[model samples]
Target chain A: MARSPATSLLPGITIILAGAAIGAGALTYPLGSVFRPGPGFFPLGLAGLLMATGLGVVIEARGSDAAPPEPFAWGALAGVVLSILAFGLTVEHIGYIPATLLLFAICAVFERFRDWKRLALTAAIISALGTAVFLWGLGLPLAAFGGA
Target chain B: MDLLAGFQTGLATALTWHTLMYCFIGVTIGTFVGVLPGIGALAAISLALPLTYYLDPTDALIMLAGIFYGAQYGGSTASILLNLPGTATAAITCLDGYPMAQQGKAPLAIFVTAINSFVGSSIAIILVMGFAPAIAEFALEFGAPEYFSVMLLGLVAASTLTIGSPFKALSMVVFGLLLGMVGTDVNTGQFRYTFGLFELADGFSIVAVAMGLFGVAEIISNIGQPQSVIRDVGRIRMADMLPTRAEWRQIVRPTLRGAGIGSFVGALPGTGPGIASLMAYATEKRISKTPERFGHGALEGISAPEAANNASVQSAFIPMLSLGIPGDAVVAVLMGAMILHGITPGPNLINSEPQMFWGLIMSFWIGNLMLLVLNIPLIGMWVKLLSLPYNLLYPAILVFVCVGVYSADNNVFDIFVVLGFGVLGTLMRRYGFPATPVLLGFILGPLLEEHFRRAMLLSRGDATVFFTNPISAVFMGLSVLFLASVFLPGLRARLLRQKPGAVAED
Candidate 1:
């Protein structure tokens, strides 16, 4: 669990900044009296608590044997993120089937065994099953080929 | 309602063809995911949430609860056969179960776990049937102050009791609370943190957030990791599965003790089956005269914790049903499902929805019996499922996640919400923040705040209203004690230092 001091402190700083952002946004709302709390009351309290915990994290990190964080799996992250994004951006526009195939195409980048023919077959099967189950069977108002 | 009447209603509700069919579907899906390594009960429940939009609320709840306890049964199959736990709660089973499997006693180990799981769940179900209504009756006297204090205790216990840096978990809880504040305020008609988007008015979709955190994030982490190879499970005759008289005698006492521990722990406000199983395992080890025999295939090792985990999963429903408070993240998602179905799960729920409550309880008995059949006679089928390639499985899961998120509101924006949180969840995983606490805090935040504000309004802004109420005061004191348990080294060492890194989300 050993790590350099800077790496150990990174999480604490990140939390603090997040807390600050929450607090700043909360400040825009009216702070009513405790007798009649307003919209911002709970969020402001949460933000303060968040920042305090962040400080506690910092202190604890310094006192304990902190380990460096694991490196990000950029390939996996990108593949998943891009695939979901493609689906989200085009689902309503292009509809479920095309959007789903696009999702599969984007996700294929992270696969270790990418036989195109097999992949295409699997994707088609998935699309058909998804269409049959979610669209036709459940009667969800999704278009199979185009925008509903 | 009288006991006989409740049973009659439950039997009538559960025996209907559609209800029985959904129960079957739920347990089947539960076993499938539980037999798999990466996908867990939480992720599976979230995926099924959108699909259940059209079902009756009672049926939906029945199916989802089946997935939960069904996963417990499925998890042990992997632990015993492949030495790979199907779920986190089954991790303890690997200690003795794998050793027994290695010794060609796999059939015996599998039999013991399946039977013990049934025993544990049956006991817990009985407890739920007896206690839930009584607890709800007591909770009917609670006001806003009591609700706030108890919820505060839940959030605190969730953060502090989990295995990790308490401060990091606390940060995630508060972060979740902040996320929960992103919609319109009910007290005033003002939009909060909406940034001019109308979709944000109702709040970030709970399904989207849950999927992103548990589902998408889990897939991202599991992807690119080397998949474990499944070994061939040799032929097993039915005769091998039957326990000898001595083995049966050895298991009975441990199973009973485990059920007791699991029911107690699972009924608590912030604990879950993972903790219950670990505590049960430690207790077994401490009391055994031959502790040295434990890891090498002791029947007690496999029996107690399997029973404990299953028992805990069933008993965890007590707090959720009685107080509308979830003890863990999965139950929190289940609570979210109840809310989505237009049925709030609180003190008035059992009285208001007796059919739903009693029927769900009765279904547990039916579900457990079904699982005993599925796990024992059909064990070979699930073992073959273990051989499915992760490359194929994850892509399909990704598709379900996308469709599921979109289907929640027919909004593309929710998918984006899932994506953003997916990245955030990945980063949190890398940084060692526990994700389960976030979900718990997110679900409880709005209710906690509502109760806090209401209590204050009634008390004329008097902050001490929490302490003035006896029920609220007890919970507040427990919250303080939980905090102190983490900060005080002596208490922390005594209470939580039991098998560190063992307790985790189911």
Candidate 2:
């Protein structure tokens, strides 16, 4: 039996709703703060609204006559995610230049950069320019190679 | 005399060597990014914001404002030369701009667009100088309830933005509001959805969300398209780009009309430059002696929207600088930057920091002049840039996005947040959900929450205070009217039926 796109989205929607509920419920613990309305009040209200809205979406999706959802572009999505991760993990240790270069190369994989030499040249130029402007000229306290 | 004095002071401040250099740099960079497809003034400003950390606040703002208006001028260059709009505001320009180019009138289109942009922005700047203080004083009357109602109206208008299902747009907005709720609670000092993570304490940065949604998602969507070799306008001299006498005659009236429409729409929070351009284009078409002449490369069509867009960019500042309320995401970011510089933006800003306020306003006129000078000579260079491969461009954009986000707060967590939003943005695009509404929700969500809580507190837990406030009541009425027009089945059906061509256009 094949599942409809709406049905497939149910799990994601449910998770979102669960998160909203958890977010709202956690706020109740600190409802008696000193502020006129306190911090918990807004979060709890927003979280409840969010959960209700998510549930509404789920119900609406189930009833609507919209077409099946398009298949997610997992490759491009994964490439973006990985590039972000590489930049995050390496920015401090390897410095801005190396980390940015790694990200550029990873993102290059999304588009078919058939000419490796051209790609490498472009990446190098970008890294050099970025380093000059953001690091050297701006005098950011970023590590050049690795050590602080 | 006051205007002239303000202008003199502004000129004095703007003429400083450092400020002039930064102005040149700002317009140059703004034009470059604006020429590039998918990059815009907002992205340019975001990337440039960190650099301002080292500069004088007045100079930084002067340069930033230059870039903001410069992008509007540069955006028309792409729309005229290529059918592809560099920014959403330029989308209306593409309807007639491409046709004008095809008619061997590319230079005329570019020239007229630049002139109109200059005129429109000049008029708005004059208005800003004349009325900003008065407007700011008017805005001071607004309380939390009024602000909440205004935001409610904004969100409702944002919902009408999507050409597709209203329900989907509302869902996207709700999702954004929820995302905005992450990190430590502002009032309680307790983490709400950090899930044992310390980095989430600051909440997700607007830079992360904006870069991901506009920049990264755009790259993802454009990845698989077959690459095309850039076309060359061989030996097209710069003089050839200037508008002919007849072209000027056709464009002047439309340009004035566009400016009027832009200033009015831009004063409303949430309806900004993009909407102004669309409205100007539609109004121009409606009023034209020959409506059918519009898409066939009419010079008026290009001029009107271009004028409106530039005017809107300038007029949008009225709300931000006056009320300390931003009309859109770009202005919101600007407000954040101002606050970071220890400058409070509100009613007292004009009186307290007359130099900053008047100097900034005066710099806009200078910026427009600077843009005209900077844009004309560089048209050839931008045309050359259009030849670069998209594959090469995406990587550079990715790298820039990473660097820009990373530099903000020097936190790696921002990168992950950007990535998450990028995927979500890509999905939203594919599903025909409007992204601007999400931005509106994120910006206005906290304000709405604060106001709701405040109103509740003031009324001793009763909700009637929100209704009792006269200003709030009016805004709430407008919100209801907007929502009713959108959601009521009979009205929706009638409106949808009337705009059958809208679906085809979308």
Candidate 3:
């Protein structure tokens, strides 16, 4: 159950990066007038808080005597990331049905699905049912075929 | 007389075909999710949110509410029969429930839980029917300062109740607040955290974040663990599922106590069924003359926490429906669903839309009854599902998450966001950081910020507005006291020592 200092340090880095990005975004908009709050005021304040908290976590973790952190689950992590990317890339071109089928199939691989037929069938059925429900039942403007 | 009339109207609305069908669907889906380990009710509601877009708002809400409570009942089954708790709230059930099953009394444990859940929910429903409007009316007097204080109390309570490193929990809450900052600024016309992404203009989709954190991250966690055999307790016969006279007597006092604790805890902002269940279990053990018998298969141990959890689930709606501030993540998503359908929830909602209010209230009763009936027959089926290979089950979950997120906006951007959140969630879990606080923070973050800003504006930059409002002042005082109690070394040590049952269970 012990966590490594690296585990804490990484999130600190993420917070810093997120804070910088948010702070940069805040600069683009007016901070608001003296009488009224501006669009950027909240974001700027929040970014500062995020950076401070992230830094605090890193410092606290470094000083703690807890167990070292375990290795990250990279395989499952990569599968999730790749599936999402594939979905985003294919959704517009192949449409919802095909894109979802591919996404599901890719995700199934991480779940240890070795049989191609089972994975494909499950993905196809899921895609078809999802399309029918969201598009036909709900009347959402989900494209069926790529052009449509 | 008014309470009777409200019930009569609620019954009329709940009896309709549309409402009944939705209730059935919600309870059925809820039971499945509840029985399955790792997939919580929050994910179930978030996944179902898109499907409700086509239904009438009342029916949709009724269905969602059914799922919320139904999950509470269903979660106990796995906890009692197996070592695994289907949800965190059910974790307490496992302390004694699994021992009961090991002693060949799984059905008895299930029976006790069922009755307890029924009693807990029934009491809460009666209170809601009788007192919701009165509470709503009283809440109408609250100004921005009061709302801000309430939100502040909620964040603090959520942080304290969450399991794991407090620092991580606080960080997650802050992260949630930052996430809430995405999309258009309500007071100003400009967007704050969109980062050139038009898709995020409406804010990071609640469905995306919820599903990613609960659903997709769960799948990732499961993948890392070695696949183990899903244990099946023999067919649960009706005879075995009925509680004996001795068992009933053992559970009665605990059930009543659980109901009382659950109702009050559930009414508090941020604390919900999860905290209530833990507290109820610990309290029951403390009051028992023979505390030594607790983890060794005591029916009261199973009954008190299970009953309290379900009761708290029903009562948690009080703050959400009456005050318009969701108490937890599930309720937060429920609030989002309501807003998405153009139904504004608040003090005036009951007055403005009595049918909607009454229909939702009525549907909750029907949903609870439906869940009880649906769960009994399905217990066998769920036990059978435990035998299914994780490989097959995990893929189906991913498909559900993928399709569920895609349907939210018909945009691929959400799909990407879900993946990003999935990674974030997995990392959070690995580091022992609780995800629920993040959810609470995300849902309440904007409301907090808005109210805080407004309070400041009205006070002309003076922070004393928070202290000036009587209601807000009282809550802030309590918040400071609670924080001190939690952080002060002597007080923390004393509180920890007093809750010996919780420590043992942990």
Instruction: Identify the candidate with maximal lDDT.
Output: 1
Which DockQ-derived CAPRI band holds candidate 3? medium
Q: Under CAPRI classification, how is model 1 graded?
A: high
DockQ-superior candidate, 1 or 2:
1
- Runs with alpha carbons beyond 4 Å of true place in candidate 2: A1-23, A32-36, A55-72, B1-9, B238-244, B489-506
RMSD of each: 1.4, 3.4, 2.9
lDDT of 3 at B102: 91
lDDT of 1 at B418: 91
Task: Mark the 10 consecutive residues where model 3 chain B has the least summed lDDT.
Answer: B497-506
Number of the candidate with higher lDDT, 1 or 3: 1
lDDT of 3 at B398: 66
Prediction 1 TM-score vs. true: 0.98
lDDT of each: 0.89, 0.74, 0.78
Model 2 C-alpha lDDT per residue in residues B114-224, reported as the tens digit of each score: 889999998787777767778777767887778777767767766654456665566666656666667777666777667778887767777788777766777776675
- TM-score winner: 1
Candidate 1: clashing residue pairs, number: 0
Model 1 chain B: lowest-lDDT 10 consecutive positions: B497-506
For each candidate in turn, the interface RMSD (Å) is 1.1, 3.3, 2.5
